[model samples]
Target chain A: MTGLVSLFRRLEGPQTLGRGPAFWALFALVLAGALAYPLFSDGYTVGNTVYFFVWVFIALSLSLIWGYGGSLSFGQTAFFGIAGYGYGILTINFGAAYGFTWIALLLAIGMAALVAALLGYFMFFGRIAGVFLGIVTLAVTLMLERFMAQTAGPEWRIGAARLNGFNGMSAMPPLTIPWFGGPIPLFADVGLYYVVLAMLVLVYLGLRILMNSSFGNVIVAIRENPERAEMLGYDIRKYQLITFVIGAALAGLSGVLYTVWGQYITPSSMGMTAASLPLIWVAVGGRSDLTATVIGTLVVLSGFQALTIYGSQYALVFMGVLLVLTVLIAPNGLVLGVIKGITKLVTRRKQEAA
Target chain B: MALLQLRDVNKHFGGLHVTNSVNLVLEQGEIHCLIGPNGAGKSTLFRLILGEHHPGSGQIYFAGEDITTLKSFARIRRGLSVKFQVPGVFKGLSVRQNLEIALQSRLHGAALDKEIDRLLAFLNLEAEQAQLAGNLSHGQKQWLEIGMAIALKPRLLLLDEPTAGMSPEETHMTGEMVRRLNAAGMTVLAIEHDMAFVRQVAQRVTVLHLGQVFAQGSIDEIVADERVAAIYLGQAHA
Candidate 1:
């Protein structure tokens, strides 16, 4: 247990850790909870666990851009919706077959990245500030929503046999592992759960690498003080655009995975409500630490699931209260505050010993 | 030939002319100080040189090339660097990481680390190399800003009130560091209100009042000028 604590502590960084034994114990408990869910849970519970992992990917992407890059976006859902629809349209409507579906996913991510580049180019270059950036992104979400709504009409609608308008696209084929001879049955919820778990691990490792690279340092520096970064000979807009695109691509990947899990893609997923979830996850998880974001997602989603089962409408009220309290009392988020408190307690103990 | 030259630079906000046709020349390896009363457009002229703001009507030449329309980042890439009146180090980055970013702008691959280490030792920031920049003292922040400007060994460094909020000892230390940098063959243009510090280090001085050059000469010449003294007193004694 001590060795495991040390490993996670090393991963978290000295700036993020506490020196207290109590804090380590609590951290260990949380890690055990996260790792044990898939192992002991039934198929239905594991399916929800898979859903949470997919959301974790989305939350991580948001944490990178909004939390680290300091660019608040309300257009992330557009990337998710677009990519999901792109995959569905390519595979189902066009009958592009199996290997081509993977290619389609990549193309969807690239398209989403290109859109982010275009949006970031306009916003950062134009020097749009604060609420104006919010408004611009909100406007983009509304525009995409309107475009998807209109697709139900004559111009682009593939009829009731296709897109299905607000009803969403469904009946996506299950992902196949060609090495295993044929497609993994989508009905095998446990199998899908493991696949999602592997993807989440891979995505987490990839993000960790990107965040530690020289390019990631540039992104964080830009977040801290863009003017200073520019004075230091960095092309601030270029970095902003690149970070935005990378973040958008990550969202696209999550969206593709989400469609696979739910086997559906709806226009509502591209709306403001869905867009805001990832931001909330980043805020609750703590912006500075990526692992905190995953924990935050698990905590919030678990609370949400529990509330829905017990008291349907009241669950949303509980989340609202929790968000307000977290913002007012622990604006740095729960994980960071807990770490700091533990560190202080440890320092106080060492002083007493001396 | 002058490394940088400004001719007939004018800036106006409403009816107020902040800079009125100010002319100046900065030769290679010279430390030029621009000093005047508050609201005399000293910092405004610095902004013009950095391309943060364009002059109403004027021309700026850098390395004998016209750079009147270049953006701030472009000018920085072209060997012009400015440290703000308020130190602008990224608060989240460690001292070494901050230096590394600056060094990366000029050097790539294997040489980056060596350059960063050399800069860390030169700026005396090796002790707190792992500390976040926000943890640094005011004087250290000022030095870090200067270190960032000199990262690529820029041909010209423009400092706006480098020691605006430092103790006497810290100010003295900053003055010594500026001298060391100047002696190392980098041209410096410092905007300072500290007459004593400017007198101690400046090779030349330019004085601006109500948006125009009130006087221009050595520090001794400007300080001793009768008209310059009256401008400092807010009296029309020209």
Candidate 2:
């Protein structure tokens, strides 16, 4: 019972914003509204909203890696591609009977994490930092994209699944759960939407608890001053690698979801443009805080989609301009800055009233 | 037995010999100070002890165990700690958070919170416990850094210029802080430039010149030595 209390209390840690009874009430109200969203919306609209939620995992992954752990990685898309392809190959080969699809999902995510661990070992142990680390990660990402783009040959087939190269892979099974009555498919509809939303809320609260815990404190300390942290007796490389793997796994979840959403996985998903999009989403939201990253990613994604529908050529260009402005005007994060402003105003008003 | 022993330590950067055949010893629970002129390699020696830079030759023994090749974190886990030349406190974290991080390795639950409170009170930072360490005054940052180091309950503490950029009063308070740590059974090896601060804390002192130990004695004896005055202290006296 004390453990449960402490976990909930830790959600108000200083590393993140939003606390007190007012914040909790607002949080509960927002969640209730999200839960009721599909009831009033059409199927297509609800599915579109699910697309936005799917990308949050990737954005939050970047926020954890670059914002908190102090390593900017362009390789999130690489992990995404790896997991998406892994899932497509596994499900296409084994078939989804008896819900082997869930096992495939776990294995695909594990593959991404393993790759991340190996890459992180080399980069972190090699002592790569700052822009050099960014360069190395971008190089790895682009290298993977180039390799996958060339696998269009018949020799690229794995068992029954085909690596269709630039055209990408398709016909993978959607995620299914083994229920008592029968297996239920989550095909990017309201079912998948609810599952993804529940996962997001759990992940957000779980991360808050983690960042407020001792391990989380050490990760932030490493971000602040690695040498100082080392002198204080932390093996900073181990911590960095762990954070990297966790972030990569989250990116992998997005990959699997994206594949299930359209039943297709494409090489362009790992392309240069795709790799940079998550960075913009994270940076524009305020990379340090998870809540800011989630809100920022959803808002920017909705705006980008609207632009793509109305003025397709201007969509990417507008995103670029927004990223530049975020860097220039609100490098800490636009959403986070605005939230801080409101918080200050409320506190001041309370004091005056008192 | 000496708490820390460095024997025939040599380090070179290209042709320049930084720490040359240096030999030193610190008995447990003594406040020892290293003093020298600019480029005397005092800070370099501290780095060598902390394992940031390994010695070109010779060995470092802490608590009668060879720690010459252990990684810095490993050495720290073996009861060594450091407050670096610059204030290395986590600027993005709160003052209390900084101490909590330091204490977390050895404490948890209510014990961790209790230690954090004690450290904040000890550093005179209780009022600003929630303030960011970056927002602290220079003296407060230094104090917070000191609080962080002692929170480890280390057997040996290496402090490089603990009182740099401090007012005389703050410097004296730091001297008192070091003495208190020493009284609580920590062996201290500090590199300092302030003579008053040294006189207030150092029971024994070592003078280095040109990467060599030129003199070692009581603070008064070293102050009275003409050779020590000629090499390093004369400039300070001037």
Candidate 3:
């Protein structure tokens, strides 16, 4: 028994559980809640939970770049909006079926990846870092939103009597799983909830794998010190560009999932508000921990929804408060703080016992 | 032919001429020591050679190839590496991980682990391999940085104050290590303020004053030069 325990401990690395058990526990609980939602909650509540999951993916993507990769971006929503548009164009204009939609989604993700690569190459290679990178991405988001609004015009407006300007796109087709059943109506909240939940799990696992890879170590090294990473023979610019593209592609994937669930896509998705939300999610969640990012997204999104009962305006105020409090009290994020607190308490108890 | 050559290298930071038309050549297996007072542009000249700073004019030839315009990583790829004045290691990573990254860059794939193990053994860092780099003492960090520089088996290594902030014992150990490296066919260009340490290791020495080479010869000859002693060694009568 002792040998087995020691083997497990060695595999997990020293300080692994101490640094992150609370975070892991919290993630597991949230995942359990996600799994239980479809069965326990009413259709409307289930639908909202599905919406939260989509944003969780977006938040995770943002955390990967801003938190781990140490590249702040405000143009994530550009990729999100582009993916939605790709889905819309494929289903509505190109008459693509389920199989082709999947292909189109991949292609859309590729397009977003390309955009991210190009932008990162220009920005990072030119040695523009920190605030300048943020400003550039913010400008790109604003430009894309304006361009989309202009090109979308009045005629191709989504729903009748709604220019999709303020009301947004509608009647997006439902995703079908041929093996399980025919078309699963995304309007069926349970179906969408499961789909989003499954995607979130897959994405989290994929990102976990990525973060553990040697390439990911290089990214972390770059984040710690770009000059040191360069001296170690890493082409910092190439790694930065690759990270940007991967993060953007993930954001685009989340966008596709969001459009399918919401049955709509809007120019607003490319706006500053949408772009900023994911960054806030990263801030609320510990930037270094993906599980914390998901938790932060769920908490913030739930708070926003709950506040909406009072008034829509209060949501932004709540977010502002959360941001300020998290930054001041727990700059590493609430999850990290809680984990550290727990570890300290445990160690204190151990010392007392000794 | 020299392993590394800088011909009339000039670097100007706006109005200040940091490296003013300096020429230097380092032969293979040579321990070339650069000594200068503070602000004598020794660090600046090192940066210029490592491609961290572009020379305003003139050329840097490495193994007969002009590498003046190459980027830092490109120069590193061409078997040129540098250890900074301040020990530069990834603080978040473990000692072994730091060495692993360097080894990976040099060898990649299957050979990475074996190479890293060899380097760990060479540096006597196998015991502290799992320790975070940030936890390492200043001297240890310096040794780790040197270990990383040699991980790629670079033909020419530029070390900027390798013994700075080290204990006497650590300094002696580092000097011995540098000698071993030089004897085993690595060309080294080192900057040092400690004349005693330099004398113990460097076969040839160049003393810099202002931004130009003040004197260059065998250590004994340069030490004995009256002009060098008067101007650089701060002796009124030499």
lDDT string for model 2 (A162-222, tens) is: 9989999999989888788988988878998998899899988988888888888998999
Between candidates 1 and 2, the one scoring higher on TM-score is 2
lDDT of 3 by residue, A77-192 (tens): 98888777766666555443555666767776787888888888899899999999999999999898886676545675443323355456666565655444654445548877
Residue A71 deviation, candidate 2, in Å? 1.2
Q: Judged by DockQ cut-offs, is candidate 1 incorrect, acceptable, medium or high?
A: medium
* Candidate 3 local lDDT, B12-54, one digit each (tens): 9889988888998899889999987788899999889888899
Q: Comparing candidate 1 with candidate 3, which one achieves the higher lDDT?
A: 3
Worst 10 residues of 3 chain B by lDDT: B229-238
User: Ten-residue segment with the worst summed lDDT in candidate 3 chain A?
Assistant: A10-19
TM-score of each: 0.89, 0.97, 0.88
Mind giving the per-residue lDDT tens digits that candidate 1 earns over A232-262? 7778888888878887888888888888778
**Residue B60, candidate 1: how far off, in angstroms?**
1.4
- When 2 and 3 are scored with lDDT, the better candidate is 2
* Residue runs of model 1 more than 4 Å from their true location after superposition: A1-42, A154-161, A185-188, A340-354, B107-127
DockQ of each: 0.71, 0.92, 0.64
- Kindly report which residue pairs in candidate 3 clash with one another: none
Ranking by lDDT, best first? 2, 3, 1
Please, what are the lDDT tens digits per residue for candidate 2 over residues B13-68?
98999999999999988899999999999999988999999999999999999999
Candidate 2's error at A143, in angstroms? Answer: 0.3
